[model samples]
Target chain A: MAEKLLEIKGLKTWFKTDDGVVRAVDGVDLHIDRGETLGVVGESGCGKTVTARSVLKLIDMPPGRFEAGEILWKGRDLIPVPAQEMDKIRAREIAIIFQEPMTSLNPVYTVGDQIAEVLRQHDKLSRKQAIAGAVEMLRLVNIPNPGKRVHDYPHQFSGGMRQRVMIAMAMSCKPQLLIADEPTTALDVTIQAQILELMQEMKDKLGMSIMLITHAMGVVAETCQRVVVMYAGKVVEEAPVEALFGNPRHPYTQGLIRSIPRVDRAAAQKERLEAIPGSVPSLLNPPVGCRFAARCKFAMDVCVKAMPPLKEVGPGHRVACVL
Target chain B: MSEPLLSVRNLKKHFAVSGGVFAREVDRVHAVDGVSFDIGKGETLGLVGESGCGKSTTGRCILRLIEPSSGEVWFQGADVTRLGPDAMRALRRDMQIIFQDPYASLNPRLTVGAIVGEALQIHGLAKSRKALEERVLELLETVGLQADHMGRFPHEFSGGQRQRIGIARALAVDPKLVICDEPVSALDVSIQAQVINLLEDLQEKFGLTYLFIAHDLSVVEHISTRIAVMYLGRVVEIAGSRDLYDTPLHPYSEALLSAVPIPDPTVKRKRIMLQGDVPNPIRPPSGCHFHTRCPIAKPDCSQRSPELVEKRPGHWVACHYRG
Candidate 1:
């Protein structure tokens, strides 16, 4: 078995919202082996982003609180680490790529300069060497005419190019783990493919583990080796990509798999998709027992009475359901 | 086909790009350049493209939300482009629009009932206050929302519920046509399916025609009777949904379809990934709009633009190389 690069155990991240405490990450246990790609799939407010943020201690304090969890990075607990130490680990050991590159990238600064700044701050490289390294990073990500485009402002670059620049910057420090939260959601399909391809290439070239956070199951099936299905801030299912798609154990996962409109010739005749009936439960005062019980078709009395713990159903396949 | 419900001819929307201190018009961004299509009565026409590809612009042009630069918008039997404000107001009764972001599209201060009833009141469809309330409640139920939800604000509802409210508002006027601009893109995977299914159910029940504009090919394939692929302000491919996805003729359409990551992990596709970014529409490539990124480009591709020509029965393609 491959060595584990990151292991999250019983993680619980909560936020103090106006209504009450929102259990954004109720209890998520996930692990990523070295050089592996793990996809965390969930809808908006499912707490996938919150879980990713907790890995780096990026969540804002006061409102955001780590209730009970162990974010183990290379066997070291990150939850209790000092802010200064956590800052060092961020971007050096682990880096994140956001959904929107326009807001993420500095509008005033040139893409090259911004990338170089990361290298300079982390590696303590000279200005000239850092700029050279930045250009090289851009080249690595397949940006054309990196030398000239390096001087161009963010506005000059298109959405896809800006995303590429973001990838270059994130990959500049050569982190052991890359956390991409909806990285290609903002880009067009063609550009999204290019970015996904670039990320795949970067992962292979650098031998880094990627925790892909996206709502799109297609993206997960295409990029991820293992898949983690999250709902209402909890891990409902985890399995290898093939197993998850082939035979989804959890009701929520099953609903998601069935809901996506397939482009395959077989699905050409499908008139109506199997859309899940209800919306995701609010984190604030979430329903008792199974978080998905209200919307789940297979909900039993036990499911509504108490939450099911994540239990292995098959080899490397876990599901959180009484059934 | 009984003169098709909506016919757009040479539709173009160009925004002037001004530079220098003088703010003079240096060029124009050809958002929707000479794109033409027809939507038969009670048929769903899916407009798909990457961001900045003018899919949304084309939809907006039909409703005169963003006035087209030059085009003939033939709705029913009248040229909507020439309609005065008062006449256009009357036309709105027969046509409505559903926006992508349900949160932003709705008025935060207004109750759900008011939001849905506003359209009916504006169109003079409701006879009395009680009648308006009853109609609003009926619309709410039609969209899978409860009567209690009518009293709630937008913030009280989830993203999916907000989308339902948007749908209810669109259906309030009993419009013949609804321009749904990326309606489900803003929704989650599970919620997206719900909205898509609701749209389909509503379409069948009311015999409502839809110009569904979205970027996701798979989602577009599910609801659309016909699909139109746009690239940089031009319609590259337009065909029946099944035919277009199964056997895409245009290089752009083929590449775009190939890029859609299928949820099934077992399916491995040979993706014809295009090169580089979508060229700036302000200074678009001289010939074909997609020639800069066309994977199967020839010498002539950069010299002359291709007109949309019917390649097969009910299938139109704009490509020099494609038969």
Candidate 2:
């Protein structure tokens, strides 16, 4: 296997509120190989986004705290890195494309200026050089009329176009690892495909790894090689994309896959949709043992008694369930 | 089929946009234009489109939530388009709408019971205070919510729970037709299935017809018996769910279908990457509105507008390149 670009081990993130402590991300472990795409799939409040933010140390710290974790990026421990050093890593080594483009990009700055700012910060390039590089990055993402669009503000662009600009900004510094947190969730399907294709192309051209966090299993199937399924606040399952889709070890994964309506499946006259019975457990005071035990149809007494650790079910396939 | 439940013809909604201090109508946003469709009794029709495509506007227009500039909205042999305010208010009992954002739709100041019971009070369904309380509990239970939750406010519940309350409010009047306007789009993926199943169950139990409007095609396919594809305020294609997905005759439909990523990795789908953003609704491309970004557009596509024609049984498409 190629060298791992990013490795996360025993990561835990928690948010303390007046009501109680919310374990947003609890004990998530994964690795992203160089030039590979790893998908993190989960419903809202499953800690998927939190896990991504934790990797980047983007969480606000007074109420939100990183309990324990080792985030190894290119053999360096990101967790123990100094704040100033981490800032360097964030700008030069790791970049994130947030879910909402409208809020992510500064409205006051032109798209070109935003991208140029990143280049200027990391590479210490001149304004002219940075602007040229920004235009190049825009063109690299397949944005048409890049020269003209670079001068346009975020609002001047459409939702899809703004997303493209975000991607361009994220890639301006040419980071080794890109964290795309639900980048296409807000986009329409047609435009989503375009954005996904652009990301895939950028991955190939830039030789950058990606940690894509999204709820859409279809996006995982299309772009990712490895998959991690999260429920409530823990990693329920992790496997190769093909293996996970073909034989979902976790019941939650099975329900998610079955819920997605496919054209081929519709043609086969499948009337019974495999919907999970109950809603996701509340993050504040999530159930002990299995977080999904409340909703899991196959859950047993062991599932309720004690939390199941991710046990290796097969080679490279791990599931955290007591079935 | 026993006089379709609802029929819409040549529906058009135009919003005036002011330019400057002159306050002149610089442009009219053609939110919905020349759209027509019919829903069979007790059958769900999914209106699938991207943002700014007018699917939601069409739903709002049918309910007279927003007045249409020109169109005919006929419901059960009555021309509802010409109905006066009092007549429309009376007709509202038969037509209800479940908004997209559960958080925004429900009033924060009101409790769940009052929110659900308000509809009943409006239509005079409940005679007294006791009857209203009983009816509110019944509505909550019908939508899979607890009777005790009636006392809680919208913020007290999760996204799925709030949506259930929204559904309860919509069903309070015993509506014949419900317009579910992207009701599940704002929900978590796992919770989405639960809500969808709830909607399907309610539809069956109440013999209700749904005009389901959403940008997500997969969700629409799961619930809708028939599907209509809209683009730039026009109905590009309409057909049975199976037929539309199996063999989409319209180029736009084909592109939209191709854009949906299949969850199965074994099945390789050719993603049709539509270039450019959705054309400005205010100045949509002349003739065929989709010609600007359509992958299979011909020269005549710009000069001649194509009318929706039935190419096969129960399948209608509007395109110049059908041959």
User: Which digits, one per residue and each the tens of the lDDT, describe model 1 over residues B1-323?
Assistant: 23499999999999999999999999899999999999999899999998888989898888999999998999878999999999999999889999999989999999999999998888788899999999999999999999999889999988889999999999998999999999988888888989999999999999999999999889999888899999999999999999898899998899889999999899999999889878878888978888787778888888999999998999999988896
TM-score of chain B of each: 0.98, 0.98
Residue-level lDDT of model 2, residues A97-152, one tens digit each, is 99999999899999999999999988879999999999999898888888898898
Assess each prediction's global lDDT (C-alpha) against the native: 0.91, 0.89
- What fraction of the reference interface contacts is present in each model, in order? 0.86, 0.68
What docking tier does model 2 reach? Answer: medium
Tell me, by lDDT, which candidate is best: 1
Candidates' chain A TM-scores:
0.98, 0.97
Native RMSD of candidate 1 (Å) = 1.6
DockQ of 2: 0.68
For model 1, the stretches where C-alpha displacement exceeds 4 angstroms are: B1-3, B20-22
The B-chain TM-score of model 1 reads 0.98
